[model samples]
Structures are given as structure tokens and as C-alpha cells.
Target: MSSSPFPDTDLAGNDARVGDGRNLDSILRIPVLMQVVLGSATMPVADLMKLGRGAVVPLDHRVGEPVDVMVNGRVIARGEIVIVEEDNSRFGVSLTEVVGPSAADQNT
Candidate 1:
């Protein structure tokens, strides 16, 4: 396989670059769902049903632990939760570990 500076396919991943003048613009325009996972917890249905408005579920991660940044369904990076200084109402992640393509490939 070789690197393609120009797009060779359509939005559906079909060969369209030759068929039409379309470039990778369509693919680039596609929306990807990115997620920052703080933590998660698992509990029995009975215990879950007992929860109320003020319910608090403890997560497996520690307070200072780095959170995973996932794209689609794969973990792409890790970062710490941060509060936006410009807007206190908004929160963001400060990336600490970025997974390169080679590094990510090795992990799998």
C-alpha cells in the first residue's frame, strides 16, 4: 500500500476520485463521535433500581487519574480533566498521553 495525498474514494469508501472530480472533502466533512470517559461503574439491577435523585455511584478511577479519550470506539489518547479558565462553566481535557499510529497498533 502507498500513501495517497489525494483522495481515492467517496464518502462511502468507494472508488470515486477517478469517476468524478470529488476529493476527500466529503470524507473530511463526515462527523466523528469523540468521547471523554470520566469513569464507569457496574451494579446489579436491583441495586440500580433503588437509586434516587441524589444517588452517587463511585467510579473505579481515582480523583487524579487520567481519563481516556475515545474516538468512535477506540482509545486514542489519555488526559486529565480541566476546567476552562475562560469559561468556568465549561470543562475540558488536558491531553497528557497521545497515541501514535504505530504505538496504537502495538497495543492492539
Candidate 2:
């Protein structure tokens, strides 16, 4: 019989087996890049080059529209921008919807 390298018990001494008894802790620690896309715009190179400080570029989405939350360039969820009450000067994303496996795969 072969022995597995991952510990069978979690830190609390409870069986840590995930679906089919696979330990997920180690893989959970792996980092992935996350991005919140507010919107996007397209413009001619000449117009793009004219962008300067205080210049506004119109985006496809309107205000209050849900923004896509991407992981490694794939959309995984959607959220809305919210002001962080803890720090009024900053903003945060409040997840509104979690993409299901089918939707996530389609986005990719």
C-alpha cells in the first residue's frame, strides 16, 4: 500500500478529507490572480494617444451595472462597487452573484 504525503487529520485533529478523501488545504493555499473589471472602452489610436490627466473615456457599462470578477483572465463572478465604510476613502466590491461551473466555463 502507498502512503499519501498530506496529513489525514486537520489542525483540529478532525478528518480533513474533502470530496473523495482528497486533502484540499495544500491546493487551497496556491494563489491565483484576481481582477475586478469595471468596464472597457475602444478608441482610435490617435484618440487614445490624446488621453491626458482628467480626460474621461466612455465605457460600455452604465453606472450601477454589475462588474465582472475575473480569476486568471476568466470571469468567475459578478459584483457591484461599494464604498468601504471602515475606510471611507477606499472602495470595495460586494459580490452579487457567484458563477456556476457552466457559466464560468463559458466565460473562459
Candidate 3:
């Protein structure tokens, strides 16, 4: 296993993992939010029992508007729906509009 020069110090202490420390830059080259779009939600069991094949569980979004993209329960961005192919589709949220906890996000 790779070891940290500052092994005694934990990540929270410095947010640094050992290596060339320079080689660590490669981690940044990796995609930032890959596969983060998958989602599933659970409501009350009573509600689940009410659902049927044809029933529409209204999503918290409106037509022609960007839907709130969440990850692990935090609202991250807004995006409109897109159909890439006949059998596959996905959302394309603008990175520029990704939401953060405050009025301003560092990404913006």
C-alpha cells in the first residue's frame, strides 16, 4: 500500500494523500462527478402501497424546466431532460448553474 510521508497526520488534518504529491495532481485529472446522477427515493410505506403501474407519482419539477439534481440528498444542479438515443436518455445540467449551500459557489 502507498504510504504518506505525513502518515501520522490524517486527511482532515491536511487533505493531502502521499505520493509525489505532484503525482497526486493526476487525481484532479480524473472526472469530478462521474456516475453521480443515479437516484432512488423512498417515501412512506403507505404511499408505496398506493402506487400502481399506471399511477404518476408527481415529481417536484415542472415541464420545460430544469429538474433539481441531487446527490446523497443535497441539491447540486438544475438540468433539462434530453433523449440521446431511442433507448437511452439523461439530463444535462449546466455546470455554470450548479447550486451550492451559499449564494455563490466556487465552481461558478
TM-score of each: 0.73, 0.72, 0.45
Q: Which digits, one per residue and each the tens of the lDDT, describe model 2 over residues 1-108?
A: 229878767788877767644667667888999999999998899998999999999999899999999999878899999999999999989999998667556698
Segments of candidate 3 deviating more than 4 angstroms: 1-44, 85-96, 101-108
For candidate 1, give the lDDT of residue 44: 100
Candidate 2 — which residues are off by over 4 angstroms?
1-23, 103-108
Top candidate, metric TM-score? 1
Which structure is stronger by TM-score: 1 or 2? 1
Model 3 Cα lDDT, one tens digit per residue, 1-108 = 448554644555553444648447757677544333433465899999998899866554456655667655567776665665645655344443677675554446
Alpha carbon lDDT at 54, candidate 2 = 100
Which parts of model 1 have CA positions greater than 4 angstroms off?
Answer: 1-15, 18-22, 101-108
**Candidate 1 lDDT, tens digit per residue, 52-106?**
9999999999999999999998888999999999999999999999976666577
- Order of quality (lDDT): 2, 1, 3
The deviation in Å at residue 63 for candidate 2 is 0.6
